[model samples]
Target: MNREAIDILVHSAWKLLEAKDYLGARELYTQGLKLDPFDATLWNYRSNAHMKLQHPELAFTDAARGLQLLDDKLATTNLSPEDRNFSVFMKIDLLFRCLLAAENLDICQTALKYIDRLLTNSHLLSNEARQTILSKQKSLKLKIKTKRHAFARASDSLRLNLNDVLNLGTMRITKYPWNEFEPFNSENDIETELKEINIMLEPIAPKLLVVRM
Candidate 1:
């Protein structure tokens, strides 16, 4: 297609995006790519449209392609001011979304690694954008840390002391209201059990109350 036709397609697609008609935007972007298959800007817009549609895997694919095309263009000569800015923000945002869409820990970590690399390139991203990306990184890191810590704690708890745990081999876990007031059990027996538990927990309860205060 000629330059004018390509421009028209790109402009129309952009307007569709502005209206939040992601499916429409993607349709136009796909048509535009047919005319100028190597247009990184078109790919970037398409990627964003897919992202807004909650098609993260497709979004990541298009974003990666756009980045590759941008890198090739940069290798030959510098990007125009508008293109440069878009490239910078697109890289950061795409990585952020990709990280969020990742289902597994390994994929999340991989996406985060790329995000950190982008954050380090001070020349590409403005200070405000860098800070925004950094905040996202911090949140993802904390989530990962919490998940790992919980897993580790669970693993640790599994190594119980059989001596302290009565009838460790015969024990069966029960849901709360452990066993309904059994008709076979006397009120006195239930009261005695409750009293013993309260006595055992009495010292800890006072410490907990003080901490809460």
Candidate 2:
């Protein structure tokens, strides 16, 4: 309701944040936001405090709010270049916060989206910042690939093998009953005729191997 009081609250909040009083800073930011819910600065400050307190979900939400507010402000026509750049930097900062929160939450996909967004605004970034983001992008891609491979391996390892089910303690299974295989056209037909189809075959090394000692 009071602009002056809200400004005071924001200023005091920054001071507390600087003094490493994250709890106090968070409280002041929340009070200021209550008076002016759309204040981007308040949201940004509060997001930082949430991150300091290890609340990544809350931090991501607040940072996203700050970014949305800045985007609306930047869309207004006839803005001075100085004002535009100021808003641009603030947007970048909020985006970085979102990326950090996503990473802390182990949501690599969300972090990758934020990284791509930062890269889309590459013209606004300093050379050092651009380089850092590029490095992070590569690292994130590799991490995602690694996770995918591990999941694939785990799925194969955990799948139920019909051969194992048919194994008697005194005997070995030479073949699995393909008669029970799923996705078949008919339950009564034991054999299906092969259809002639055009296809390409590529030669590649096998992925997994076992050697008897």
Candidate 3:
């Protein structure tokens, strides 16, 4: 890798990123990666570009590769505490992007697994970032749970009587003429009352009131 070229690429790519030129930054990042495929920072930045373009699968892939490279570097290299912490933070942030990029339940579950693993080692993160990740984790868990139960809830609703199934008790129609009949109840009750009234009027059907001139 040419150090001078990498410096130029990094500088220009960062400027492009700041300017929201995600495609331009991505191209530079890709060029950088060809020179140093093991560069985790390049991977992370490239992932960012992909995310901005809504290329979730590519973003997730790059982010995951970045994490692997970071872990390998941490194990073999004697990095300063600040540098190590920053790398870890970047990885966590990338994990969040991965979560956001998830397009389906399976992908979401996979992202959750990675997130939970990082969260379990919360000491690797700053307090503020840790809290943010925890809150997001909780929200994601709730979203997944809700999605999983949605069908069951829909089916359960099928068994429900929207009108009256809670046994909330019936209302009364004791207002004026309505009081002459029974209280307002179920539809079945109303139908029964109508049937009884029709039965009582069966004989009256033949009677007619006539007028003579």
Best model number under TM-score: 2
For residues 1-213, could you state the per-residue lDDT of candidate 2 as single tens digits? 479999899889889988999999999988887777667777788899999998887788778878877987999988899988888899999999988888887777778889999999999889999998888888888997886667666668678553443222211111111211112232332223210010111123221111111
Candidate 3, residues 133-169: lDDT per residue as tens digits? 7786787788767754774566585875533432232
Ranking by lDDT: 2, 3, 1
Weakest lDDT window of 10 consecutive positions for candidate 2? 194-203
Backbone clash pairs for candidate 2 read none
lDDT of 1 at 140: 70
What residue runs in model 1 are displaced by over 4 Å at the alpha carbon?
77-107, 153-213
Report how far residue 210 has shifted in candidate 2, in Å.
48
Give the Å shift of residue 122 in candidate 3: 2.4
Candidate 2 or 1, higher lDDT: 2
Candidate models: Cα lDDT each: 0.60, 0.71, 0.65
Compare candidates 1 and 3 on lDDT and give the better one: 3
TM-score of 2: 0.69
